[model samples]
Target: MLSDFLHEYFLKLSIIVAVFGGAFLGIGIGLVMRAGAALDGIEVLALYTLKRTSFTITEIILGINIIIFSFAALKFGIETSLYSVLTYFAATKTIDYVVEGIQAYTGVTIISAKSEEIKHQLVNNLGRGITVYKGERGFLPGKFDVSADCDIIYTVVMRLEMRKLKNLIYEIDSEAFVFANTIKEASGGIIKSRVKH
Candidate 1:
Protein backbone atom coordinates (compact mmCIF):
# COMPACT_ATOMS: atom_id res chain seq x y z
CA MET A 1 0.00 0.00 0.00
CA LEU A 2 2.81 2.43 0.83
CA SER A 3 4.56 1.59 -2.44
CA ASP A 4 1.32 2.12 -4.37
CA PHE A 5 0.82 5.49 -2.65
CA LEU A 6 4.33 6.65 -3.52
CA HIS A 7 3.95 5.46 -7.10
CA GLU A 8 0.68 7.32 -7.50
CA TYR A 9 2.15 10.57 -6.19
CA PHE A 10 5.54 10.32 -7.88
CA LEU A 11 4.58 12.39 -10.91
CA LYS A 12 2.96 14.99 -8.74
CA LEU A 13 6.00 15.19 -6.47
CA SER A 14 8.31 15.51 -9.47
CA ILE A 15 6.20 18.27 -10.96
CA ILE A 16 6.23 20.18 -7.71
CA VAL A 17 10.00 19.95 -7.50
CA ALA A 18 10.38 21.07 -11.11
CA VAL A 19 8.12 24.07 -10.61
CA PHE A 20 10.00 25.16 -7.47
CA GLY A 21 13.34 24.67 -9.18
CA GLY A 22 12.24 26.79 -12.14
CA ALA A 23 11.00 29.51 -9.79
CA PHE A 24 14.35 29.63 -8.00
CA LEU A 25 16.18 29.77 -11.32
CA GLY A 26 13.93 32.58 -12.44
CA ILE A 27 14.69 34.51 -9.26
CA GLY A 28 18.40 34.02 -9.79
CA ILE A 29 18.17 35.23 -13.39
CA GLY A 30 16.22 38.27 -12.29
CA LEU A 31 18.92 39.19 -9.76
CA VAL A 32 21.65 38.72 -12.38
CA MET A 33 19.77 40.93 -14.86
CA ARG A 34 19.35 43.58 -12.21
CA ALA A 35 23.09 43.47 -11.57
CA GLY A 36 23.75 43.70 -15.30
CA ALA A 37 21.49 46.73 -15.61
CA ALA A 38 23.40 48.34 -12.76
CA LEU A 39 26.65 48.51 -14.75
CA ASP A 40 27.78 52.13 -15.37
CA GLY A 41 24.16 53.27 -14.82
CA ILE A 42 23.62 52.91 -18.59
CA GLU A 43 21.69 49.66 -18.22
CA VAL A 44 19.44 51.26 -15.63
CA LEU A 45 18.73 54.09 -18.07
CA ALA A 46 18.09 51.59 -20.83
CA LEU A 47 15.81 49.53 -18.57
CA TYR A 48 13.90 52.66 -17.62
CA THR A 49 13.48 53.63 -21.26
CA LEU A 50 12.47 50.06 -22.16
CA LYS A 51 9.80 49.97 -19.46
CA ARG A 52 8.24 53.25 -20.51
CA THR A 53 8.26 53.18 -24.31
CA SER A 54 7.00 50.66 -26.89
CA PHE A 55 10.65 49.66 -27.49
CA THR A 56 11.41 45.98 -27.03
CA ILE A 57 14.22 44.53 -24.92
CA THR A 58 15.87 43.28 -28.11
CA GLU A 59 16.43 46.76 -29.58
CA ILE A 60 18.40 47.80 -26.52
CA ILE A 61 20.45 44.60 -26.72
CA LEU A 62 21.19 45.08 -30.40
CA GLY A 63 22.13 48.70 -29.77
CA ILE A 64 24.60 47.61 -27.09
CA ASN A 65 26.01 44.99 -29.47
CA ILE A 66 26.57 47.61 -32.21
CA ILE A 67 28.71 49.64 -29.81
CA ILE A 68 30.62 46.60 -28.54
CA PHE A 69 31.24 45.31 -32.05
CA SER A 70 32.47 48.68 -33.28
CA PHE A 71 35.00 48.80 -30.40
CA ALA A 72 36.01 45.16 -30.97
CA ALA A 73 36.51 45.73 -34.70
CA LEU A 74 38.97 48.59 -34.01
CA LYS A 75 40.80 46.82 -31.16
CA PHE A 76 40.91 43.30 -32.64
CA GLY A 77 39.92 42.66 -36.26
CA ILE A 78 37.02 42.09 -38.61
CA GLU A 79 36.93 38.34 -37.80
CA THR A 80 36.46 38.76 -34.03
CA SER A 81 33.99 41.58 -34.60
CA LEU A 82 31.92 39.38 -36.91
CA TYR A 83 32.01 36.59 -34.33
CA SER A 84 31.00 39.04 -31.61
CA VAL A 85 27.99 40.11 -33.71
CA LEU A 86 26.78 36.50 -33.94
CA THR A 87 27.41 35.94 -30.21
CA TYR A 88 25.60 39.13 -29.33
CA PHE A 89 22.61 38.17 -31.45
CA ALA A 90 22.40 34.75 -29.73
CA ALA A 91 22.75 36.33 -26.26
CA THR A 92 20.07 38.90 -27.00
CA LYS A 93 17.68 36.20 -28.17
CA THR A 94 18.45 34.08 -25.10
CA ILE A 95 17.87 37.03 -22.76
CA ASP A 96 14.59 37.79 -24.51
CA TYR A 97 13.51 34.17 -24.18
CA VAL A 98 14.41 34.08 -20.48
CA VAL A 99 12.84 37.44 -19.72
CA GLU A 100 9.61 36.30 -21.34
CA GLY A 101 9.21 33.24 -19.06
CA ILE A 102 10.11 29.61 -18.49
CA GLN A 103 7.72 28.43 -21.22
CA ALA A 104 9.54 30.64 -23.77
CA TYR A 105 6.74 31.19 -26.24
CA THR A 106 7.52 32.84 -29.59
CA GLY A 107 5.40 34.96 -31.91
CA VAL A 108 5.96 34.15 -35.59
CA THR A 109 5.17 36.50 -38.41
CA ILE A 110 5.53 35.13 -41.92
CA ILE A 111 5.04 37.08 -45.08
CA SER A 112 4.85 34.09 -47.36
CA ALA A 113 3.09 33.84 -50.68
CA LYS A 114 2.10 30.28 -49.71
CA SER A 115 -0.39 31.41 -47.10
CA GLU A 116 -3.09 28.79 -47.71
CA GLU A 117 -0.64 25.92 -47.59
CA ILE A 118 1.07 27.27 -44.50
CA LYS A 119 -2.28 27.88 -42.83
CA HIS A 120 -3.46 24.37 -43.60
CA GLN A 121 -0.26 22.82 -42.22
CA LEU A 122 -0.38 24.90 -39.04
CA VAL A 123 -4.07 24.24 -38.40
CA ASN A 124 -4.27 20.61 -39.43
CA ASN A 125 -0.82 19.19 -38.76
CA LEU A 126 0.39 21.39 -35.87
CA GLY A 127 -3.05 22.26 -34.46
CA ARG A 128 -2.07 25.94 -34.29
CA GLY A 129 -4.06 29.06 -35.13
CA ILE A 130 -2.87 32.11 -37.06
CA THR A 131 -3.96 35.66 -37.74
CA VAL A 132 -3.72 37.04 -41.26
CA TYR A 133 -3.01 40.65 -42.08
CA LYS A 134 -3.70 41.81 -45.60
CA GLY A 135 -1.60 44.80 -46.56
CA GLU A 136 0.79 46.34 -49.09
CA ARG A 137 4.24 44.73 -48.87
CA GLY A 138 6.77 46.91 -50.66
CA PHE A 139 8.55 50.16 -49.79
CA LEU A 140 12.15 50.02 -50.93
CA PRO A 141 15.06 52.13 -49.72
CA GLY A 142 17.36 51.17 -52.60
CA LYS A 143 15.42 49.14 -55.11
CA PHE A 144 12.58 50.98 -56.85
CA ASP A 145 10.12 48.10 -56.81
CA VAL A 146 6.40 48.46 -57.25
CA SER A 147 4.22 47.79 -54.17
CA ALA A 148 2.16 44.64 -54.08
CA ASP A 149 -0.57 43.45 -51.74
CA CYS A 150 0.29 40.54 -49.44
CA ASP A 151 -1.03 38.47 -46.57
CA ILE A 152 1.06 38.36 -43.41
CA ILE A 153 0.44 35.31 -41.22
CA TYR A 154 1.06 35.60 -37.52
CA THR A 155 1.05 32.81 -34.94
CA VAL A 156 2.04 32.34 -31.33
CA VAL A 157 3.78 29.09 -30.49
CA MET A 158 6.11 27.53 -27.95
CA ARG A 159 9.83 27.69 -28.75
CA LEU A 160 9.80 23.95 -29.38
CA GLU A 161 7.32 24.40 -32.21
CA MET A 162 9.19 27.33 -33.78
CA ARG A 163 11.77 25.29 -35.70
CA LYS A 164 9.19 22.84 -36.99
CA LEU A 165 6.96 25.66 -38.14
CA LYS A 166 9.83 27.45 -39.82
CA ASN A 167 10.86 24.30 -41.65
CA LEU A 168 7.33 23.72 -42.88
CA ILE A 169 7.19 27.33 -44.07
CA TYR A 170 10.54 27.13 -45.89
CA GLU A 171 9.57 23.86 -47.53
CA ILE A 172 6.60 25.63 -49.06
CA ASP A 173 8.08 29.06 -49.83
CA SER A 174 11.84 29.30 -49.88
CA GLU A 175 11.71 33.08 -50.32
CA ALA A 176 9.35 33.68 -47.43
CA PHE A 177 10.12 36.48 -44.98
CA VAL A 178 9.67 35.25 -41.42
CA PHE A 179 10.39 36.92 -38.09
CA ALA A 180 9.95 35.63 -34.54
CA ASN A 181 10.03 37.16 -31.06
CA THR A 182 9.63 35.82 -27.54
CA ILE A 183 6.18 36.55 -26.14
CA LYS A 184 5.82 37.76 -22.55
CA GLU A 185 2.43 36.21 -21.81
CA ALA A 186 -0.46 34.61 -23.66
CA SER A 187 -3.95 33.53 -22.60
CA GLY A 188 -7.53 32.72 -23.59
CA GLY A 189 -7.22 31.04 -26.98
CA ILE A 190 -6.09 27.92 -28.79
CA ILE A 191 -2.94 27.85 -26.68
CA LYS A 192 -3.44 24.50 -24.91
CA SER A 193 -3.77 24.17 -21.17
CA ARG A 194 -0.65 23.97 -19.01
CA VAL A 195 -2.19 21.95 -16.19
CA LYS A 196 -1.28 18.27 -16.36
CA HIS A 197 -1.46 15.30 -14.04
Candidate 2:
Protein backbone atom coordinates (compact mmCIF):
# COMPACT_ATOMS: atom_id res chain seq x y z
CA MET A 1 0.00 0.00 0.00
CA LEU A 2 2.76 2.44 0.98
CA SER A 3 4.77 1.52 -2.09
CA ASP A 4 1.72 1.92 -4.32
CA PHE A 5 1.02 5.38 -2.89
CA LEU A 6 4.65 6.45 -3.28
CA HIS A 7 4.86 5.05 -6.77
CA GLU A 8 1.73 6.91 -7.84
CA TYR A 9 2.67 10.29 -6.38
CA PHE A 10 6.48 10.12 -6.23
CA LEU A 11 7.46 8.49 -9.47
CA LYS A 12 8.91 11.83 -10.54
CA LEU A 13 10.75 12.18 -7.23
CA SER A 14 12.15 8.70 -6.91
CA ILE A 15 15.69 9.89 -6.22
CA ILE A 16 14.63 11.89 -3.16
CA VAL A 17 12.50 9.02 -1.97
CA ALA A 18 15.34 6.57 -2.38
CA VAL A 19 17.85 8.71 -0.46
CA PHE A 20 15.51 9.54 2.40
CA GLY A 21 14.21 5.99 2.60
CA GLY A 22 17.75 4.68 2.78
CA ALA A 23 18.73 7.23 5.45
CA PHE A 24 15.74 6.36 7.65
CA LEU A 25 16.45 2.66 7.19
CA GLY A 26 20.07 3.23 8.18
CA ILE A 27 19.08 5.19 11.27
CA GLY A 28 16.77 2.40 12.35
CA ILE A 29 19.42 -0.24 11.74
CA GLY A 30 22.04 1.78 13.58
CA LEU A 31 19.80 2.21 16.59
CA VAL A 32 18.98 -1.49 16.60
CA MET A 33 22.65 -2.45 16.38
CA ARG A 34 23.56 -0.02 19.15
CA ALA A 35 20.96 -1.69 21.38
CA GLY A 36 22.83 -5.02 20.83
CA ALA A 37 20.45 -6.35 18.22
CA ALA A 38 20.83 -7.42 14.60
CA LEU A 39 18.37 -6.57 11.82
CA ASP A 40 20.11 -8.13 8.79
CA GLY A 41 21.79 -11.44 8.16
CA ILE A 42 24.50 -9.67 6.13
CA GLU A 43 25.44 -7.66 9.21
CA VAL A 44 25.73 -10.87 11.25
CA LEU A 45 27.85 -12.39 8.53
CA ALA A 46 30.02 -9.28 8.50
CA LEU A 47 30.48 -9.47 12.26
CA TYR A 48 31.42 -13.14 12.01
CA THR A 49 33.82 -12.39 9.17
CA LEU A 50 35.31 -9.50 11.13
CA LYS A 51 36.83 -11.86 13.72
CA ARG A 52 38.46 -14.08 11.10
CA THR A 53 39.53 -11.59 8.43
CA SER A 54 41.63 -8.45 8.11
CA PHE A 55 38.81 -6.56 6.33
CA THR A 56 37.05 -3.78 8.22
CA ILE A 57 33.32 -3.96 8.80
CA THR A 58 32.71 -1.12 6.36
CA GLU A 59 34.79 -2.79 3.64
CA ILE A 60 33.09 -6.11 4.15
CA ILE A 61 29.65 -4.57 3.97
CA LEU A 62 30.56 -2.56 0.88
CA GLY A 63 31.83 -5.68 -0.85
CA ILE A 64 28.63 -7.51 -0.05
CA ASN A 65 26.55 -4.55 -1.18
CA ILE A 66 28.44 -4.44 -4.48
CA ILE A 67 27.67 -8.06 -5.14
CA ILE A 68 24.01 -7.58 -4.30
CA PHE A 69 23.74 -4.46 -6.44
CA SER A 70 25.46 -6.19 -9.35
CA PHE A 71 22.78 -8.89 -9.25
CA ALA A 72 20.13 -6.18 -8.94
CA ALA A 73 21.48 -4.44 -12.03
CA LEU A 74 21.35 -7.67 -13.99
CA LYS A 75 17.78 -8.36 -12.92
CA PHE A 76 16.54 -4.79 -13.08
CA GLY A 77 18.04 -1.95 -15.14
CA ILE A 78 21.17 0.17 -14.82
CA GLU A 79 19.16 3.22 -13.72
CA THR A 80 17.45 1.28 -10.95
CA SER A 81 20.72 -0.21 -9.81
CA LEU A 82 22.41 3.21 -9.77
CA TYR A 83 19.59 4.62 -7.65
CA SER A 84 19.89 1.69 -5.29
CA VAL A 85 23.62 2.29 -5.04
CA LEU A 86 23.00 5.94 -4.15
CA THR A 87 20.53 4.86 -1.49
CA TYR A 88 23.08 2.43 -0.10
CA PHE A 89 25.75 5.12 0.05
CA ALA A 90 23.41 7.48 1.84
CA ALA A 91 22.39 4.74 4.24
CA THR A 92 25.97 3.78 5.03
CA LYS A 93 26.98 7.33 5.93
CA THR A 94 23.87 7.83 8.02
CA ILE A 95 24.60 4.62 9.89
CA ASP A 96 28.12 5.82 10.66
CA TYR A 97 26.83 9.09 12.05
CA VAL A 98 24.16 7.36 14.12
CA VAL A 99 26.52 4.74 15.55
CA GLU A 100 29.49 7.01 16.18
CA GLY A 101 27.34 9.91 17.38
CA ILE A 102 26.63 13.32 15.91
CA GLN A 103 29.26 15.00 18.04
CA ALA A 104 32.64 13.59 17.02
CA TYR A 105 35.63 13.68 19.38
CA THR A 106 39.21 14.62 18.58
CA GLY A 107 42.38 14.10 20.57
CA VAL A 108 44.62 17.16 20.43
CA THR A 109 48.30 17.46 21.32
CA ILE A 110 50.15 20.72 21.81
CA ILE A 111 53.89 21.31 22.12
CA SER A 112 54.94 24.79 23.08
CA ALA A 113 57.17 26.81 25.38
CA LYS A 114 54.06 28.42 26.91
CA SER A 115 52.53 25.12 27.93
CA GLU A 116 51.70 26.36 31.43
CA GLU A 117 49.69 29.33 30.20
CA ILE A 118 48.03 27.27 27.45
CA LYS A 119 47.12 24.58 29.96
CA HIS A 120 45.66 27.17 32.30
CA GLN A 121 43.59 28.75 29.52
CA LEU A 122 42.35 25.41 28.19
CA VAL A 123 41.24 24.31 31.64
CA ASN A 124 39.68 27.57 32.78
CA ASN A 125 38.25 28.92 29.51
CA LEU A 126 37.50 25.74 27.63
CA GLY A 127 36.47 23.71 30.70
CA ARG A 128 38.56 20.77 29.47
CA GLY A 129 40.86 18.47 31.40
CA ILE A 130 44.32 17.91 30.04
CA THR A 131 47.24 15.57 30.55
CA VAL A 132 50.78 16.87 30.54
CA TYR A 133 53.89 14.82 29.77
CA LYS A 134 57.37 16.04 30.65
CA GLY A 135 59.67 15.63 27.66
CA GLU A 136 62.86 17.04 26.12
CA ARG A 137 62.91 19.37 23.10
CA GLY A 138 65.54 20.99 20.85
CA PHE A 139 67.13 17.92 19.33
CA LEU A 140 68.60 19.44 16.17
CA PRO A 141 71.47 18.34 13.92
CA GLY A 142 73.70 21.19 15.09
CA LYS A 143 72.35 21.07 18.67
CA PHE A 144 72.25 17.28 19.10
CA ASP A 145 73.92 17.57 22.53
CA VAL A 146 71.62 20.44 23.63
CA SER A 147 68.12 19.85 24.93
CA ALA A 148 65.52 21.50 27.17
CA ASP A 149 62.64 20.18 29.27
CA CYS A 150 59.11 20.91 28.07
CA ASP A 151 55.52 19.97 28.79
CA ILE A 152 53.52 18.13 26.12
CA ILE A 153 49.83 18.96 26.55
CA TYR A 154 47.20 16.50 25.42
CA THR A 155 43.43 16.82 25.61
CA VAL A 156 40.24 15.45 24.09
CA VAL A 157 37.70 17.86 22.63
CA MET A 158 34.58 17.63 20.52
CA ARG A 159 35.00 18.35 16.81
CA LEU A 160 32.92 21.50 17.21
CA GLU A 161 35.27 22.75 19.94
CA MET A 162 38.44 22.00 17.97
CA ARG A 163 38.54 25.41 16.29
CA LYS A 164 38.03 27.25 19.56
CA LEU A 165 40.75 25.18 21.25
CA LYS A 166 43.20 25.75 18.41
CA ASN A 167 42.44 29.48 18.29
CA LEU A 168 42.92 29.82 22.03
CA ILE A 169 46.23 27.98 21.97
CA TYR A 170 47.54 29.91 18.97
CA GLU A 171 46.39 33.21 20.45
CA ILE A 172 48.57 32.51 23.47
CA ASP A 173 51.52 31.24 21.41
CA SER A 174 51.50 31.53 17.64
CA GLU A 175 54.40 29.10 17.21
CA ALA A 176 52.79 26.38 19.30
CA PHE A 177 52.94 23.07 17.43
CA VAL A 178 49.42 21.68 17.62
CA PHE A 179 48.06 18.44 16.16
CA ALA A 180 44.85 16.46 16.47
CA ASN A 181 43.65 12.93 15.73
CA THR A 182 40.09 11.72 15.25
CA ILE A 183 39.02 9.65 18.26
CA LYS A 184 36.69 6.76 17.39
CA GLU A 185 35.66 6.38 21.02
CA ALA A 186 36.54 8.09 24.29
CA SER A 187 35.42 7.58 27.86
CA GLY A 188 36.35 8.30 31.46
CA GLY A 189 37.95 11.42 32.95
CA ILE A 190 36.39 14.89 32.51
CA ILE A 191 35.28 14.31 28.94
CA LYS A 192 31.88 15.65 29.90
CA SER A 193 31.48 19.06 31.54
CA ARG A 194 30.01 18.97 35.01
CA VAL A 195 26.48 20.30 35.26
CA LYS A 196 25.87 23.05 37.80
CA HIS A 197 22.80 23.03 39.97
Q: What lDDT score belongs to each candidate, Candidate 1 first?
A: 0.71, 0.83
Residue 176 of model 2, lDDT score: 91
Query: Which regions of candidate 2 deviate over 4 angstroms?
Result: 1-15, 50-59, 71-79, 135-149, 194-197
> For model 1, where is the 10-residue window of minimal lDDT?
21-30
Write model 1 residue lDDT over 47-113, tens digit each, in one string.
8778887776656756876787899899899756765565555555555545665566788999877
Task: Judge candidate 2 against the unseen true structure and give its global Cα lDDT, from 0 to 1.
Answer: 0.83
Model 1: how far is 173 from its true place, Å? 0.7
Clashing pairs in 1: none
lDDT of 2 by residue, 46-144 (tens): 778978997655567667887899899988988888888877777777877777787879999999999999989988888888999999888668977
Alpha-carbon deviation at 58 in model 2, angstroms: 4.6
